[model samples]
Target: MEDGMGFWNLRNFNLAMLAKQGWRMIQGNDSLLYKCFKGRYFPRSSFLDAKESLGCSYVWRSLLAALPILRSGYCWRVGNGSSISVLGDKWIPNHPTNKVLHPINELADEMAVSELIDSKLHVWRSGTIMSLFHKEDADAITKIPLSRRVVPDSIS
Candidate 1:
């Protein structure tokens, strides 16, 4: 029974190590896995799309095997709103649609949520919100708190 418990602990530890390494590879662009794929480690849309390729090293294959687990816990935490795309990013919460509620074609593809903020007052620009989003979307956007201090955007 003691031996069995020891084995179970070891198995859990191994799984945890693999998960950490997989997350590191996914987050670090300089990782060998990214280099192996010519700077593309995993798809941003979903890591489940990652697959074993011909002539790939054993380490790369191991990383690929752990992607599903990594993807399960992945989430976006909005910060300064500089890096997140208003139209393409999954920033809004509890909405049926992950993307922005309404997309304006005239807006640049790189338009960030920061653009909709009033820099002076540190709040959402009411005019911009009204112009870009519907009433419900504007309400949702307003509910999201913006940081007064500058910070980098991150994913977890």
Candidate 2:
């Protein structure tokens, strides 16, 4: 819908509005809308992972429809890292896609970032990082400093 002249597109605006609702569902766990949706739609998983069902309503379908737009920017801020998958979750910094550049190998897809961190010291295990991931990914992973205090994983 682009033209030589710079102007706002109503379609994009509408899409953005829909994506905002999806974002609110992610950030506002205490809201009634989120609570209702959680009970009916995504009881066991995150909003980003929610799936379509045969009997879902139009409004619910609309929110889920905007998920691709929401997921493109969604990323995990590492903490315990136990809940995040090394290859599946978006946690890496600097990469354009906000994902790890290296491809999964030998069940590495099932590995957690915690596996590359030393629990006692709360520091990244450099040797393990270098051994498991590509140089770029290893460097990016190391660049992200770990918290001294133990914290739960959260969305970023």
TM-score for candidate 1, residues paired by index: 0.59
Which 10-residue span in candidate 1 carries the lowest summed lDDT? 39-48
Structure candidate 2, residue pairs in collision: none
> What would the per-residue lDDT of candidate 2 be over residues 39-108, giving only the tens digit for each residue?
9999998899999999999999988878999898888888978878888889886776667887747646
Q: lDDT by residue for model 1 over 22-138, one digit each (tens)? A: 777556758655555644544443343567767767777766666667655664556777767887667777666645776667778879988987777777787888777878877
- In model 1, the Cα lDDT at residue 122 comes to 76
Q: Which stretches of candidate 1 lie over 4 Å from their true place?
A: 1-20, 24-56, 65-73
What's the true lDDT of residue 142 in model 1?
Answer: 80
- Among the numbered candidates, top TM-score falls to 2
